[model samples]
Target: MLRSDDLQVFVLTAELGSLSAAARQLELSPAVASAALKRLEAQLGCRLLVRSTRSLRLTGEGELYLPHARSALQSLVEGQQLLAGGKATISGTLQLSAPSDFGRNVLLPWLDEFQLQHPLLSLRLLLADRNADLFRQPVDIALRYGQPEDSSLVAVPVAAANRRVLCASPGYLAANGSPRTLADLVHHNCLRFMLAGRVHERWCFLDDRHRELEQLVSGDRVSDDADVVRRWALAGRGVVYKSWLDIAQDVQSGRLVVLLPELLGEPTPLNLICAHRAHLGERVRLLREHLVERCQRLIQLAPFAH
Candidate 1:
């Protein structure tokens, strides 16, 4: 039988693509990760990884052993969950990832309340705009906007948000003149969000007959950061197409106005995603439930009221 500790370390290292990254996730040193891998390889009498200064690659022998090791680890984890006393009491660290703006405006405030309710539990929250790889990153759960592309991860729709609308400060609109039609957008400066080498310069709208109209927009300013785009709009730099949750305050306060609300299309979904662990732990389950409940309430409360 393989040592559980060694198996755990090996699996983590494989998932993370590097021993150092795995060590960081496990809160261990790089030397410790290397030693554990060496021990694991020694016990099996086969080299599992082709290691280099920069990256790790699994050997053919290692690939064959990986599935079995993963299954064993999962079974062990599930067994522990079955032995846990009850659902009411859960203790462990729950690592989570979320978009920067959502985490700041919506999630961070509720965390205090969640912590107060479950004093034994700890949390590690990573707020980023880009999608975090749960399998590679060791995150227990992630709050994400839009459907998850990874089939391996389980996604639960936690909330819903409308697609971005063209918005600009009243001052800017007054100076540049509000667009009367979709075609007029070409004449106005449009702020864009560039993600993964794709710039969202084409604005999609609908006519009175509900027919789709695609407008190609251009501007001098563009960024991947939603907050940055919102700021630029607020500063009267250009018209921004932003998520409603992101610009709710500006809209409510009359600082910004939705340029073409009637033409805006369907709402996009927000989801809570997690790696498909064989045994869903009590802490993970509890946190998932808590987030779903809180998000529901947040949607109803309209906390973005400006």
Candidate 2:
């Protein structure tokens, strides 16, 4: 088998575009780095790098092998981490981001329970309506609604079957009268929220006919805070279209009533998002499994979870 260090030298050299730079990063001398590269190439029976004193570049064979080499290194690192911290002791600060409403209302208690179970684990939670930049932000994972737009991000399902629900407080329906049909929403006060600097006034759902419909709604109140919208709905001020996980307890407690159960709501599948699969360490995987169980239980308990 090829020495892992040699593979590292080659990968780092390809990435940094300098054998000397790769050597500096690995704390190896220039000669040793060069020798490692030669050994790696010799084992593969190909000239991997076109080298000169002025510049270095990968040959076609080197370009093809780089990704595999990187994957091998990453696998090695993951295996080491799994063995070192995967057991009874999980000691690390897990930084996470989540939506303001779900984070505060739902996820907070669950995380508390998780921390209680793993006493050595520390957590830093950021609750905001806006999505966190996994590449730039300090957050290691994010609990987000809907699928990520950026295909590069890894989205592991926490609640894949979760969907939005149109709901209102009993008092609100009693006073304003219930909307019997999709067109009747024009007469109702549909609560709205702002995200990514835009007001989400269009409520999307499937009609009784199973056709996709987008209802442009308006209300007297609007806020960027999602909890405020749910609160407004609870206060009987307006109707809300929100995730079932966030409002399941409210619905179960008779604080809010699901509307238009005949019409299918837009899918808002929740996911634990990360920048790469390598970020799904043992802790993250365990957390995800925990959430999946909790979320599924809540969804099943609700009157109209779908």
lDDT of each: 0.74, 0.85
Q: Give the per-residue lDDT digits (tens) of candidate 2, residues 235-287.
A: 99998999999999998899999988888888889999987776677678778
> Which candidate has the highest lDDT of all?
2
Cα RMSD for candidate 1? 5.2
The alpha-carbon lDDT assigned to residue 38 of candidate 1 equals 94
Minimal lDDT window, size 10, model 1:
297-306
True-structure Cα RMSD, model 2: 7.8
Candidate 2 residue pairs in clash (backbone atoms < 3 Å) = none
Give the distance in Å from residue 111's predicted Cα in candidate 1 to where it truly belongs: 3.3
Instruction: Give the candidate number with the greatest TM-score.
Output: 2
Per-residue error (Å), model 2, residue 207: 3.2
